[model samples]
Target chain A: MNRIAAFSIGAASGVVGTYLTLKEREDLKVEPKVFKYGRPDSPVSFHSYSAHSLAYDRARKIPLWVIERLSPHDIKKEITADRHRSNFQPDPFVSPHYSSANTDYFNSGWSRGHMAAAGNYKHDQKCMDDTFYLTNILPQDLDNNIDYWYRLENYCRQLVKKGYSLTVISGPLFLPEERDGKKIISHQVIGDNNVSVPTHLFKILLAEREDEEPPLLGSFIIPNKPVSDCPLRTFQVPLETIEKHSGSHFLQNLQRNKALDLCDKDGCKTISLNELTLYRYAQKLEQATSKEALEKLWAEMESKAIKLDKHITAIYKKKMNEF
Target chain B: MNRIAAFSIGAASGVVGTYLTLKEREDLKVEPKVFKYGRPDSPVSFHSYSAHSLAYDRARKIPLWVIERLSPHDIKKEITADRHRSNFQPDPFVSPHYSSANTDYFNSGWSRGHMAAAGNYKHDQKCMDDTFYLTNILPQDLDNNIDYWYRLENYCRQLVKKGYSLTVISGPLFLPEERDGKKIISHQVIGDNNVSVPTHLFKILLAEREDEEPPLLGSFIIPNKPVSDCPLRTFQVPLETIEKHSGSHFLQNLQRNKALDLCDKDGCKTISLNELTLYRYAQKLEQATSKEALEKLWAEMESKAIKLDKHITAIYKKKMNEF
Candidate 1:
């Protein structure tokens, strides 16, 4: 890029113009006409992180959207982050007043839920901890965060396990409801900082198709309240619906009809906690089989033989092989 | 800038990366670390215009904020754009469903208020017309839009007339209000598209200081409803208040105590409509004075002389010269 010596015509000396050093922007993206006199400095900032990237909505004290890329290998890694160690903390990068604090969610009957879903970033401890930052948080209903939202996250990982590169975009929504012949957008704001409690939360799952041209684009908008045993498919919505309300576009090349439906391609059903409990129980049962018990007995016998002497251990090994 | 052959790591092949063709982004602003597997694509889209620039909130269906630049010379231009000819229209750059339309405002009771007020872009017709696009609009209270909001805009122009170059950052605010025991953020949504009627509107005025280290930064948050003739200064707030609520920092160098207050520096009082009406009336009265009456009499005499004869007109001019 050649050095374009021209300056913006409009006198836009707002704080956002200096977000990056002028010298940094001196190279490009400086449209002479737009910033003819000054930069088109809007009151918004973009921040990128390891596990996820987000556009924080400073006004709402919530992220506009939290974006994350997930792969089966990353999700299925044996060594994952420990949730107990990571603490919910205010984002240091965000100004104190704009960044949400634990106090905001304290005694407010709400939970600070991760939009980037900490469980999804399990490949590394730091990557998982990154999702704990309030910048990636949303004021969510307690029961809903634990039950339905938790299950939905698993559903995302399940898709990855099925072998598609998944992009998860999640955020809060202040949906308008009809009242007195007029639609009203209303939600609770918690704490001294007044973090908004969104009326609804949306998650868009964009998965790359194996054979199709455009990726599978699926979006869902669910209420913040708990849904008792309701199918996840009930929340399914057109990707455009989320885009229009969120004021963002997903993929330009995406085609709805021809593109594989995420739900149809891979069932929208979530594995129940009861089933997971039983599966763990069955694994324990499987480990206690006669062959496993015999192996354990042989190991104990070998240890006893070692206690006796090296000659005894050699004799014990021969006996174990014969068995 | 070298051709960074690296693609993003966490797969973020969302639409935003393709916003300005992938080729354009091949050089810079594409941080390999952030988009290590894919792009760190957030749904938010930034659109720059001749009169203003804005970050459209895809979820909220409103601009996160509107930025504009103003100067005294531009405001005082002899020939300005005619507002009557400009029509309010949907922003073509925005998708149909996401973009606000005229039908969205039809019979909604709320008025489509311009964030970058049309009056401020009077220098060029096209610039003034650009403000009419819905991308620069917010659904606002009609009375407030016409009276108090209108005055605030004129106040901006008047500030320009005072010689300081001004930057106005304006947007809707759904501030939390204490109700019953908890704080609630509530606002009306109008029409089929559910366009949000912001509970409050804010204007942050950033004026260049002649000698001060940083610019004067002042902001105000006024309700969407009429103020019942209250002084505009009553709504004066610290710049941080707006930034904190909006979630975007204005200027990094701005120190509230050291930097001048825009309201204090310019005198927060707005020129009221009554005062404006009286001033216009006074101007009309000033035009019809005694000197003007004497000139009118001579002109009538000259016309009468012409009716009589050309020689008589010369005599009348000579006689009138003595008077």
Candidate 2:
């Protein structure tokens, strides 16, 4: 509280901040010059899969972020990998003490939503299957998981379909909002392990256009809850905001000023999901645990007000039962 | 909520847990045995100082932990360095985006408290000053900073005086407690940069006694707020608990059964602060900002009872003014 204030801090810091200027290894040497005491250990760890790489948060038992690159060739026409053949599983590489488990999401009134969407990795069966690992999932809201968020992922692929390849980064965010005059970041955690439920989710993309034009960089910070009313462009934010919130720098290889705004270049809009897709979504929603949530899901279903023919309902019911 | 329950999580996890069985760099290669994608980037960074090394959380702009090995020789007689001459400064190596500044704590109604204390590094002025880097600091409460927590640090040095060399790990914790039937971790952030103010602070100590016997490991997690009534031993919890909360492993090379309890070996008690010591603390208190806080601090002073008379008060006032 002894108010040292800003000017003093800025002045004092400019002198000592140079300690790390020598290298990215950032060895800091001060006067009287002494060697480092010991090696530093990473509080978080990174893992790789066929289509993606992710940094896991050891403390939260969740992935901090997932990075994936999608090329036109990687986005093939038919499903080369059937997601149905792949069941969700825990990652083998992470220690049990730190890794998230499939059960963390099972009946916790939340769905294990993929950060790197399984459908995006369909070029190879293994690529799609690996996306089911717990490290790539989060305790996501059912509505957000299978509906709007699903559409966003589709939107990413739509761009790929439009002849642009993309490097996508997705992650959870425990964002602070003004609550009762204080900026508070609060979220529920699931399972005995207390795996966190993020309040928001982010997707940052670098889409490389054909020809000599610079690639476009765009970012979205969407609420974890469903948002069906607004356009996808409403969620778009500056890249610096994402770095400030996620603590991870993205597109380090690209100069941001030279890059174009993704949403500006290619409009951010999601097509309405077909009826069969919504029925399939209802199947995933069946796994949600909370009694109130089940009731709420039914309420939402009733509000949809679109009923398919009896034959389709019968077929959907059979498919749902099989699932 | 689909309450999948604890049993389901435990059951599902045991089957797929072996992916990391091969190595610590747990490369989880699933069916199809495909090579990994690009390398995952670390969300956090690490840096080293002469007396300590720390893992810095890039997003939070704070050190996750600071570790120091304090031997008998390291605890020099009298003071080889005066802390009065060493002003707090920022570590140059940390990028401005991810590093905490002296400004973050300035006039933020919190103190810049050192994890590896300056007093503990009196072996040399450089070592002592290196500990002042903002990377090794937290936004600490004023009352706890100079009083109870100070005594606990003194206790660590006191153990070193007893022919024991100590390896100490210190950091801040954002612990959650049951609020309205839900576990919520909530803390106020300080400065325009929103530097996090931890709700609790921890000190994990591994003290090796002067013998062939194995070392003792003990940990304490104390509330960031002032606590004048309870004994320090009340804060002593099992090592496993600290691991769960902090997500950092300690005594990795030593088996638990061989190690003894640190608090049991040396009684967990703090020596009373003498009259002069209390007077100096009062001077430090003057920097505190809140009117209500100032009132409460004076109230705490009056409750201490015994007075130090006029000449001492005059000298203390002069010192306070100078500070």
Candidate 3:
């Protein structure tokens, strides 16, 4: 038994020894890097809505500094439209009948609705109208949007009674074009129950108060309906689309101008020159470019559009023909 | 004003019309598939440890259907091994240490060390140790590993008593690597904090359990010290050495396998097969592959041979080197 033991020990050591010897002659290596998890610099972008839709894209663009600077009055302003436009269009870019104006007509029969009731903007119409931005909107059930949404609004009101005010945004999650090919729509769901809503109707909410509550917000809702067939009404445009439309790649540009700043603030590792160039071009488009150059840029953007119109038409035609 | 309203309506319709026309032209496309979150097909592995320096790993490569039909005791026996023999290696593999093995050690030290205390063997020990098959070990603090780790162990034990035996895996947390750009280690931390450990140290007890309560079978201790300069211990093998010892393109093989897995899982969304393959190959070389692999897999697996040798070397080096 002892001899067997010796042999086993020798064999084990020998195997290790052989490995070590080979490693010494050549080299064996292992490299592992540490990764940190926190809030991602960029959240996943949604693509069922339009680039011009305020509900889908508003909160992301609002700089943290800007949000910090905002006062109750500023929040109030977002809920209401500007006094100059009394008879404003529900949605500026698409017609009411096209499904963009009201998302209730789509397959999901849901719309991006605000938990922080748009009606709350009665105190300031400008703020309420600004809430119309695609970013604030979320896919929501019409009944739930009007009812439970109102309940949430009431909850916010109760908070205000206890000396709290909120600047909230909510929307439905939309499946990106990438996901559509799989025949499954990527909708947003909250909590363990997986309460889901149409991908187009996703929303985010941001609320703050003067008291000592640890930021009473961070939630999303998914309504259970298609709501409309019009792409703009039913989907939130992808961030890439907005970048293309604005002619400015925000992440790339931000990194270039402030490499160190980006690292310290956002934990970004590096920035590429392509991003810098895009940023510069965006600046030119915003302030320095000629109309012709801007037109050319828009034309370029047009080519890259994901073309939701085709998807809607195909589905509509199929449905009509089937009926 | 009415004309503007009409124009707005017309503009909206035109936008919808254009979208429909674009859809008819097959411009918008849906993605082909959606990604699922959990692994549905992978087999479970188990790990076990004794009061002494014995650890065992056992996993069957048999299909899941066959394995699931076996009795728990039969499954346990299939993976068990006597720890005293040098060649008593367990197939699959087990973590070399028990959660409580180093608790006494930590109590004497300044810092507390933490480890994955539960959710190992498909939430079973046997499963966890099989997972320990060289691929899962990371450099960790002894104090934290033992002290906090013991606490976590106790918590899991309590949960098991309460009929909550489900195992959960958490933290692919990224920790900083050595100053040299060699490797990064991902650490997994487990166990909930609802249960507390009894301590007879300097601090006084705040509460006591009622006599009717079940004796607290599991309790943990926190380490005295929390941080250190070189918190993690490396196996100390160079990358080049592994390739030479294994006589195989070890790193390349690992990378290829990992890349394939990633492609299958993530839909080729983030990492390419080529990149993953390259990364894996690099990792095999960094850890002294031949010696470590042989020691872990074949010899000293069920016995103290490797550890005794290590102890002898430490003593001899201390005396001889000093002389």
Candidate 4:
């Protein structure tokens, strides 16, 4: 039997002593970040420089969980996009270290998806580059990466904009895929490095209100496929579903008995930038002097907004209502 | 000058003492609901038979506001439609009241819109019929009554289904309309009863969680026009906007420093029952044994879901994601 033991998660605040432990598999070594809360007599991490902590699984070469404390201030920074591929450096912090090479993605159809998006940590150049660490990269479909997943990332940012300070945990799921009536733990591998390609990726956003009310939780689980066609809400699952699949618990200490009602299972219709931009343009068209021009613009926007997919249309309907 | 003084809102629990008063408009008598909270030290009115309370404006023969406590259970009870033109009975509760006759609506090119919809109080037959009172009725556009306004009503019910206990305040808005740089409260009066025909109607839905968090507020202001061409979200306004126009406050006692983040100002694409039903049917067809049949069904559902209004399509996208 594998040993299943709890290790105290160290933090400057003694109150935040919750643990993230394994169920039964001890083969993969687990290490929680030693959180250094700043200032004396503060019951919480009030002024800590670091906004995130990670527990990596050296065996999988991916993080077990990348927990981040995101605020509006963090996302407010403007950072230049690092479009040029940077060097994949191994963190000296991990013992028995293995560096993931950029060559591992050579000729592979998958895009190097960021588990913790670079856009999120644009607060500082160093923090932005820290997201480039090989462990944060997961094999993702290009369409899913830039489109479907991007919508969720935008929503998280929007939540922050709405004055919510979120504690987000993102990870990959290598659940057993059923084949011919049998559960099989099979997945694709890339390069000689044997970097495991996850079957699914998930993110759990725990949105905490400033008023000390129970947190609003939103969990998204999407297959490692082209998800641009689907709505963001479609990937929404109950928090319990994520826990059941990953064998991991999140915010268990802070959540206590609070209910997670943020799934919005009925879902939201997420819109593309083009669509949103078009809608904003349409709003401007409402003030057109020429009746002909206004009608023409209305007709064009109407067709696009009306002919959209149900989910997108739903989002469109919402936008239309705002008008 | 009209006296606008706050009145004591009575209930067993002192917490239910939130007042609803008017601002110098004593011409229309205002009497806020005196909520009767049940035993067990409940801060709110729970386990009470009545779903709502109203403050009717006797002079206008319309309600100043109709506030209702809505839940899934309140909407679950089956009540036969009150068709065949029910009599417009006068609410005896109001002082120095005069009964509004059905003849007032005769030859009027408008439908009698229920401020608090009849469908909402379907829990009991008497309660449902109570909505037919003349004070609850307003001169509404036929298209707006049956379509645009109906969509907002359906959404309120859906929110209740999602575990929200909503306090809904529906009223008529007689805001000053501008004509050649002139602000005028120009409105039509129908029949001898002098029933004021409002240019627009508004509803404020404050969804309170069971856990006692600050309520989520959604304010909608729909024009009394052919709103069938308009989406439900197009009418969404801020809570502050409603207060500024009406000169009435809401949730003042319950909400302290907490920000009202419930308004999806950009808007959510809320769905219609027909759209939702069709989407569910589409999901079932995915497992069809016959490939040709499955393809045919998919094509049909796809076109329907895709071609829906932006709001419905957004909902459709969420449903599609699940599959």
| Candidate topping lDDT | 2
lDDT of 1 by residue, A180-277 (tens): 87788888988888888889999988787465556676789989998777778899998767766765545443445666777886678887755443
Listing every candidate in turn, what is its Cα RMSD in Å to the true structure after a full C-alpha superposition? Answer: 13.7, 9.0, 27.4, 31.5
TM-score of chain B of each: 0.72, 0.77, 0.24, 0.65
The per-prediction tally of clashing pairs is 29, 13, 134, 20
| Global local distance difference test of model 3 | 0.26
- For the predicted complex of model 3, DockQ is 0.03
| Model 1 misplaced stretches (Cα beyond 4 Å) | A1-49, A121-123, A161-165, A207-217, A252-257, A273-323, B1-43, B121-123, B207-217, B251-257, B276-323
Better of 2 and 3 by lDDT: 2
| lDDT string, candidate 2, A232-257, tens digits | 88999987787767777666556678
- Please tell me the TM-score of chain B in candidate 1 relative to the true structure's chain B: 0.72
Top candidate by DockQ: 2
Candidate 4: tens digits of C-alpha lDDT, residues B126-197: 656667766577878887787767777877887887777777778776555445543334456565555666
For A221-264, candidate 4 gives per-residue lDDT tens digits of: 88877765556767878765664444344554554357445655
Task: List where candidate 2 sits over 4 angstroms from the true fold.
Answer: A1-19, A22-40, A273-323, B1-40, B272-303, B307-323
Q: Sorted on TM-score, highest at the top, how do the candidates line up?
A: 2, 1, 4, 3
Error of 3 at B267 (Å): 28
DockQ of 4: 0.01
Per-candidate TM equals 0.72, 0.79, 0.22, 0.36
Which segments of candidate 4 are over 4 A away from where they belong? A1-50, A77-88, A94-97, A264-269, A273-323, B1-323
List, residue by residue over B1-323, the lDDT tens digit for candidate 1: 12232222111211111222223334335453324324333434466666577766545567767878797668778666889988998765555555567898988888889999988876788878888878788888898998888888888887778776787878888788879998888888776677777889999887773645557767889899977777878999876677667665554434456667676766878876655434433334344445555456546545644233344445435544554
